[model samples]
Target: MAAQLREILLRTRRHLLLARPGEQPSRLAGEGLDFRELREYTLDDDIRHLNWKSMARIRKPLVNRYNESRQISVGLVYLNSGSLAIGAPVSKKDLAVELLTALSYAAARSGERVSTWFLGADECAYYPPGRRQGDLAERNHALATALEAKGEPADSEQLLRELGPRLRRRSVLFLLGDFMKPLDLSALASRHEIHALILRDRLDEELPGGSFLLEDTGSLRRKEAVIDPAAREHYRRLVREQDAALFEHFRRHGIGWEKFGTSQEPIARLAQYLRRP
Candidate 1:
């Protein structure tokens, strides 16, 4: 079931990427180089890219409006610590990849340069951002291969901490993970705009009363523990609380952000975000 969700995320993001109208600006700035359309000459025009030949043809002046070329630097970074193996509809780890894929496709669709980085248990991989569709495909393949080749979870917090200091540019940075491990967002917030994707598996969603055996993904560790409804309820409450607090912090700092679950239709959310006024 979780596997199917992963496939859906991949397909939906790709579709959105390909279907974007070439005339739309990547964001509110509208300073991109994409050619949008033409309009009658106005006093406040750039006065360049002006069709002088068209003026002779129409015997009138018209202004050429251009949609911004996708120039925003959007980076997708996913954390692959062992703790993400905890969900059902989508394991936290797979969902991380899916989120990265969705965001990458969306950025590319907007002509925003899309780069990707995968910090797995033992390795770190980087894929350069590019405007062509092929770049995303290559990045997706790399993400899949990295997810499959595993050893043990790496220090996710450490990864974020390191990223924070080096990135002083205004790029969109997404950090996908389950906060089962702690992170220093305050440090990251200083350098990059960080949006956190918090993932929770369906199994982690509900807890049945009584003792039950549970299995871990990579480790396959077994545990026979009593299901205290209160404990599960507490877990759910804490997750909600933390999610709100995390976004709140980003908001307070004037950092751009959005959060979604593994079950949500990521395309709609992304389209709405990218197509904002």
Candidate 2:
């Protein structure tokens, strides 16, 4: 199963690298020196790009255009929490690693740098951004080791606190975790383009009818509960309410957000998420 997951991740990386065009250049910034064209200047146009000579000859302000020269960078925040181990068939932590591997490889293949931070409550790991595709194996091994290491319970609050100071550049940041707590990401969004990928298990939202024992991975506390209709409905409603609130928060902050089930195809969901405007 591990080998298969790795293969799928590699295939997805190849697909993303070979097919997707380069990121669209921000109209406000361009690094290329090769002038492409000149057009009438708009109010928002940078005065630095204005062709003063052209304006003097034509009696109109014009802006020089050039292709985007700077490469893209992808920042990843991977959560290593005990709750991620609660899932059927495949654990959420394992799936998260697989998806993260795909994203990192794809970014590197596209000539973009990838910076990763693995967060646990007890410890945190940082991997510097690098664009060399040949270093992927070493990077993947380091990431896997970090995720599997036993540590204190990880939470969104800790992640938010630690991530803010580490972002040295304006990059697209992918924050991956099972969001079980409330988050205020408005401030983080101001410095970086943020995308929140929420990992969930169907069992969490819909419990099977039966008596079952549950354990809190973080606290190591066990409890017995009966999944009666009323209990099940209440659980589902709570999950829905939490998710709805989270969605609204992200929307207001201009951060992209999506929830993916542990059983879903990681690559397909990622592609769908990226395809959105």
Candidate 3:
């Protein structure tokens, strides 16, 4: 079933790729296959792409057929915090993986390289950019495997410290996390175009009525509680406060923010978000 969903996700929403401007010709963008005819050199053309042989033969400065040169790097960073395992219709972790797959595939289809970072409690796992056409599936597979190995709350501060220096300046970064832990994104915000995807569960925010014992997925600790009106209201207020703070931080840093619910269709929501001006 999971494999089927994966294949369907890969095939669906291909139209979004067409909307992407990555295919546009740019003298700074990297060269792609299927060379076009060479033309007279222009001031805007990069000298590195110049065809020295053609210039010598024609006695005129000419550039090669490879005109496109800008290689936009698209990166997805996932927070492997234990809170993400909570699920109502879908697990936050599962939805995150799906969203990453969709984003990576869309970027790859648009001729951009896709990279992923899975930040866990004990350690962080990095997947290098898969620029080649066939590597997308492998990258997604690796991401799926990493998502399955979730643990305690990830060390967001430490992970960011390690990751910031490695990323290319102005690269597009998509951050997926439950946002239970406060993150210091100052360095990342200054260097990268950040898209923050906050994963949440409806069950977590709105407590259901009745007395039940709930166990923490990661710690294996149990707590019995009654979900009275006051308790429910308190939970709602706390959630709102957290969200407000998170949104404020993102706004201050000029990062794009979107909330993904476990009940929502990950790809559709992301596609809609991308379509927004």
Highest lDDT against the true fold, candidate: 2
- Model 3 lDDT tens row, 237-265: 99889878878888898888888898877
Q: In model 3, which range of ten residues has the least summed lDDT?
A: 20-29
Candidate structures ordered by TM-score, highest first: 2, 3, 1
Flag regions of model 1 displaced more than 4 Å.
1-30, 33-70, 120-122, 145-157, 160-168, 215-221
Error of 2 at 137 (Å): 5.6
How far residue 130's Cα lies from its native spot in candidate 1, in Å, is: 3.5
RMSD in Å for all candidates: 7.2, 6.1, 7.9
Give the TM-score comparing model 3 with the true structure, all chains together: 0.76
- Clash count for each candidate, listed in order shown: 9, 0, 7
Q: How high is each candidate's TM-score?
A: 0.66, 0.78, 0.76
Report the poorest 10 consecutive residues by lDDT, candidate 2.
Answer: 20-29
Candidate 3: which stretches are off by over 4 Å?
Answer: 19-69
Clashes of 3: 7
Instruction: Say which prediction, candidate 1 or candidate 3, comes out ahead on lDDT.
Output: 3
- Deviation in Å, model 2, residue 96 alpha carbon: 0.4
